[model samples]
Target: MHQKRPHVLGIDDGPFRKQQDGEVPIVGVVMEGATLVEGVALTSFPVDGAEATAFLADWVRGLRWMASLHAIVLGGITIAGLGVVDLRRLAGELDRPVLAVTRRETDGSDLAAALHAAGLSERMAVVERTPPAWRLERGLYVRAAGVEAAEAERLLRATLHKARLPEPLRVAHLIGAALVNGQSRGRV
Candidate 1:
């Protein structure tokens, strides 16, 4: 018997300065098992705003390939700085696994503090309710919903190429930078 390669959509926010106010572009890259790029999704939302989850949900639900997606992976839990994503809600609404993966651990307390300071205390509550990160092999920290630990590992492994992040995410980061800055730059 042979296993199938998992298809995943990886999302990442475009470049933004901490002092910037207004919307920021977000890029989503879809890949067939971390190799072939199937498609891309694009959207934007306010910086440090509280609508991250809803906006992301709408962006994903609008995808033509949403039904076939095995999972949705994010570059991080927060987009455009303090905009937080409710992992559980996203997974439930999309009926797919959702995972936020990072090269290093993003302290939950720090995220909570940012939300609280931004006066997005309501979102802070959601952040508090969300599960903490689970450390995967190779120093990747993943905060996930709608998938078991074993399945999460399988999905991540399926999408991983030679980079530290999964292919979709890696490619999405580069695309996002180019979209916003006219060319891909900085750390990907």
Candidate 2:
């Protein structure tokens, strides 16, 4: 009997300047069981206000490896400043599991205030509708749709190599940063 490796598309946005509005480059790395780099997708999305779910869903659907993908993982729920990626909507649209991983728990009140101040109050609703983050090992928090907490954890665990984060995400972060800054400097 042959066992199939888990294939995941992990997404992360490049570093962007605050108080500035523009599109931010993002990278998506596809991996087979957190070891092999299957492929990479490169794109950009509007910053601060434009929602990312539709853009991402359409982009992902166009990928050549879409059929074999086991999951879509995001570095964080929010990208390109205040732009929010709706997990539920993405999962429903793609008919596949979608998960977001964050290093720290968010401060809901602070985020709401920031969004309101940025004149993007509607973004708060997306945050509110998202399911709570489940704590993974070493302060990693995961929020997933189309999959339960246990399975989400298992998926993440199965997708990790030597890095603390999944290989797809880690590589995507490095690529995005290097593309924008000549070289990656900070932790993702």
Candidate 3:
């Protein structure tokens, strides 16, 4: 009973300025089972903006190898500070299950305040629509779109290697970090 390992495309964003509009590098690492297969990079607006979802969707749609992917994994639910990703829209655009992974539980009040301050209060509805983050093994948490929590748990367990973060996301994080800073270090 040998089951084929699923291929996953993991995405992550690089560090950016908090106060101004700037370009942040977004990296996507494709993994077949535990093996790294491909990597792609794109840019998105700074924190508390509305460009991550469309940029990600367009990048995924343009990738010829995307058809082979079983799912999409994100390092976090937001990029460039408070620029929240619309996971549901991304999943619908790609027709693939999407999972956003985080190392800690998020504070809703704090997020709301930030959105309000940024004049992005309307974006709160999108965040509200996102599935709650579920704790998986080894202290990792995840919110999924177009995929069941149980299935996401199974995939996380299957793909994790060397750290709490999955390999694809880990690689993407490292690449993004290196691109922003000269080196990649600390928890992403």
Candidate 4:
């Protein structure tokens, strides 16, 4: 019998802040499963703080599902965004492979430095100097072993378009942001 491939988890963080009093801080995380564009699954976590760092830190601390992941993909914004998150640090905490993607021309030296500082450079993959507008929503594709790098790469490239966020992360972003947005408004 053929075995199913493991799902690659796509991880990303975003922040939420209120302009007025009595509002709660919000951070959004989107974790997507590897599959076809329609097969991706999304889960989100929201926390306090306007800084992306806060969200990342919280997400790392609260990450209870890493043991089942094959690999992790992190957004450039999440790595470079402000707050308390250290991409390298978080990668060190996990036993899985970590890849960081960005459209910028730089080497993502900062991210690499941080990961190296945390002793996780070996597990980190940086796809830098990519063409413009590569994609808006950042995420990972969870896949099973022996799935061929070309196949995985093809799937990732096909779905991550300029407009539509990857399904898993897109749904998670919406869920997390809406959750906080509703709370800030005191809505049901």
* Candidate lDDT (C-alpha), each: 0.86, 0.85, 0.79, 0.40
What lDDT score is found at residue 67 in candidate 4?
Answer: 49
Span of ten consecutive residues with least summed lDDT in model 4: 126-135
Clashes of each: 0, 0, 3, 11
Can you rank all candidates by TM-score, best first? 2, 1, 3, 4
Q: Which residue runs of candidate 1 sit more than 4 Å off their true CA positions?
A: 1-3, 186-188
Better of 2 and 4 by TM-score: 2
RMSD of 2: 2.3
lDDT of 4 at 171: 42
lDDT of 3 by residue, 71-126 (tens): 88998778777877888999998998899998888856777888898888987887
Tens digits of per-residue lDDT, candidate 2, 34-85, equal 7899999999987775758888999999999999888999998877878888
Error of 3 at 97 (Å): 0.5
Better of 2 and 4 by lDDT: 2
Error of 3 at 144 (Å): 0.9
Clashing pairs in 2: none
Write the number of the candidate with greater lDDT, choosing between 3 and 4. Answer: 3
- In the predicted model 3, the residue pairs found to clash are 47-80, 48-82, 48-83
How far out, in Å, is residue 73 in model 1?
A: 0.1
